[model samples]
Target chain A: MTAVLCRHFGLHHMDIAEDIASDTFLKASEHWALNGVPDNPTAWLYTVARNKAKDYFKRTAIFETKVRNEIIPESIENEGEFDYNGRIIADSQLAMIFAVCNPANPSESQICLALQILCGFSVEEIADAFLTKIETIRKRLQRGRKNLRNNSFQITTLNETDIRSRLPIVLRTLYLLFNEGYFSKTSSKQVRIELCSEAMRLTLLLTENTLTNTPQVNALLALMCFQSSRLDARTDIRGEAILFDEQDKSRWDQSLIQRGNYYLVNATDRQEVSKYHLEAGIAYWHTAPADDSKWTHILQLYNQLIVVEYSPITALNRVFAFAKVHGKDKAIVEAEKLGLEQNSYYHALLGYLYAQTAAAKSIAHYEQAIQLTKSPTEKRTWQKEITLLRQDKR
Target chain B: MKEFALIFRLTDISDFQPSPEQMQERMNWLGSIAARNQLVDKGNTLLPVPGSAKTVKPDNVVTDGPYTEIKEFISGYIVIKAATIEEAVVIAKENPIFKIGGSIEVREVLKRD
Candidate 1:
């Protein structure tokens, strides 16, 4: 079913392909429920899909004015019924990925459309995944599709020459897919298994493709593998989020760590460093921790990241890394400038800084943090930090 | 590109004091979502009643009166990118305000140009 859909998508319009697929399923679903299961469900689905495709083209002759003449003859419609041996040149999913995430549209729209068309996510599901309104995701998807059509987007043929230029966007899309899987801001549940698996599948595909087998691609795959290995440990048995320091190291997959190390070496082969390279370095540091003192190198990487990204969020992250290297004083000095004191993490960081200094102002920061944070897990963590600070002073 | 104004009105503020942790959680949820989606060009949450001055004209005389209505106050809004009214409606359905109690009025934002 997947292969047939891919083939049809490449030869015909994707909108037509999608509509045909949807009609086929609607018929199959209704038919199967009444007539019991068919002997060959895949074949049945193909016949339906092909017939729907023909009907769609016939019906939409007005809007399909651009390529009205390109439709295959009625006799050829049955030819795609069972061409299992025929060459499947380009992957439809690949075309869809490039078409949706085309650089012509905004980044958010790219991600939203990719999630919807490629991953088959509903607007509500995507909204939950990114912790945004359903309207935002819907608009992004709609706009992205319109833009792609208007721009006459040409999907980058995943060949050796164009791979280097387009690889970064693909990798970023994969990263977003994985992050949505690993830590969904909207789902009350812990993780999105489907999204995670889809991301992993795409990454594996990228690694397998001769054109996309770059050191950075390998590094991204490795990072995903290593990070995913600990997904089981990220949430407690109660299904609440577990802080990184509290996670059971024994639960971390050794094989994935080894794979991560392999990619880390590959990523460093190029003298130029990207954010993924720094991220992989951080992941590696976490993997092989003799003590918390070894985090200085990781801090240096975050410093480099801030210079490149110049995000207040990145700067906030670097402050914690600084605490691991220097004392709380240096870290607090950095954190103070981030203006995150109005947020929850700021209070948690403040509480820790106060614990180190036993200063009266530290309590105020902790209180502010407690006031700002929303999650129960985060609140508890900050509360614990505040309690410890008070205990030390007493 | 078409324009749409998402008029988000905060409804039913329960006698709830969101602890700092809750505030952080909300901020993280909102900030990350906004960053990922880029839904708004710029937005600011209005204070409950940021000292308002109202002039009441009664019998050809002007008088100062605090004019407030619970149902029709504009809390906040975001101007967004949309192609059509249906698209705007689809986007509005996903708003946090529209979940259980609150509502968002999605209208085409008029362009000056």
Candidate 2:
């Protein structure tokens, strides 16, 4: 059923494909539990899917009459590959992805909608995944769907020309989705391993597709591979976060590192200097042979990343890389410019940098970092730094 | 072998009346729980007390039948088979039908020796 959905819908509509498949199975389970098991399971599954799609359309119509215009008629007459009834919607997943990624809607909304509709996740689950409220997710999805309808966004297959244009947004959405699943933003007990795996699977699909084999895609894939290699070491026996430097590097999946390196090399084949290229390069540099002085190489990549995507977090990372490549004076200049006390990570890094300088204010910066950080792990790490700095001052 | 009955008493507060749906949900949850533990023999809700007048020896007095200052009136309860007060108290923790500002008072039923 999932394969059929993939074949019909496309790779992007993962949420929808999973939803329909799950719904079909749930119906099957409920029916078989109540009555005896059906003789023909596949036909029964299709019937259930058809009914679900119909019900969905009816519900959509009932909720908003405006959407009635966009509703695909259930009539089997002249039904082709796009028909949801007996004709079977070929590449439906891709169609759904393109619809969600439609330029009419905001990028966040597109990603949220894809997560909700294609990925079969409830708004609450997505909300938990992103550390946002359920209401916020609902609103975003509502706005996104409305935009999709308003724009009348319908495209079957993306061309090479447009794939490059759309691929970054697609990659970013998947990357963030994987991140949320890997490290759930909420205090939920279980890590959403399925979401993370699904995101990687989708990225692999893009990588395999003829039109989408761009350098950016390769870079993103590389980044995901490198990050995924450390998934096991991210959480300890108690499921608490482990610091990056403190992680057991021996436990890191060597196979994933090799794969990441492979993609990283592929990403460099193109001339364009995308943020993914720089970010993946940085990841490769970290996971490379530790003894090699790759700091200069990494510092250059960070500089490029900063130029492309100068977000606060990126800037913070850049400062650390600069500190490694250059000396404390150059690093401190960049750190001070960021107003370290405001951002916890920035403050923590500044505290470390100041401690290295053996300055009197290092303790103050560490204290500021400890106060600013909310994460228990982060706070503990910073507090330790503060203690060391204070002892050094003595 | 010893047989003991735990008589659990409860009161319904009028201001804390739950909606019909909420009441149904609470009742369903409680019913399932009681059935699972075989604690409930019977339970019910009584309508509000009516005003009544009674003639005394010398003077006539007119007041509500309940004769209580507290808002809550004796609502309903279930009979439980328990060996001791400690056991009955443990059962009380699992009761799902406790509404706002309501309390359960459990007492040992005296068996004639």
Q: Which tens-of-lDDT digit does each residue in A1-394 have in candidate 2?
A: 5434544444333346567778888988999899978887767887787566446545655555565555443322222342344323424444455456767777778768877766767888878777678899999988886776566444445566666677667777787777777666443436466677767777777777667767888888898888888888777765566777789999889999999989888888646878788888888887876553687677666655654554677777767876776677777875665543578777777777877665567777778777876666566666777777667665
Worst 10 residues of 1 chain A by lDDT: A81-90
**What do the candidate models score in CA lDDT, each in turn?**
0.64, 0.65
TM-score for candidate 2, please give it.
Answer: 0.63
**Whole-model lDDT, candidate 1?**
0.64
Model 1 ranges with Cα > 4 A deviation:
A1-13, A30-44, A58-90, A154-156, A159-162, A265-268, A337-344, A370-377, A387-394, B1-113
Tens-digit per-residue lDDT, A1-394, candidate 1: 3324544444335565566667788899899999988998867877677666556655665345546654444333444453433233235455556556578787778777777677677788888777778887878777777787788554434555555676788788888888778766543543366778778777777666566667777777777877877877777665567778888989988887887777677667666777777777777777776575567666666655554444545656666776777778866765664555456666667666766566467777777777886655666656776677677784
* Local error of candidate 2 at residue A97 (angstroms): 2.4
Deviation of model 2 at A229, angstroms: 0.8
TM-scores, one per candidate: 0.65, 0.63
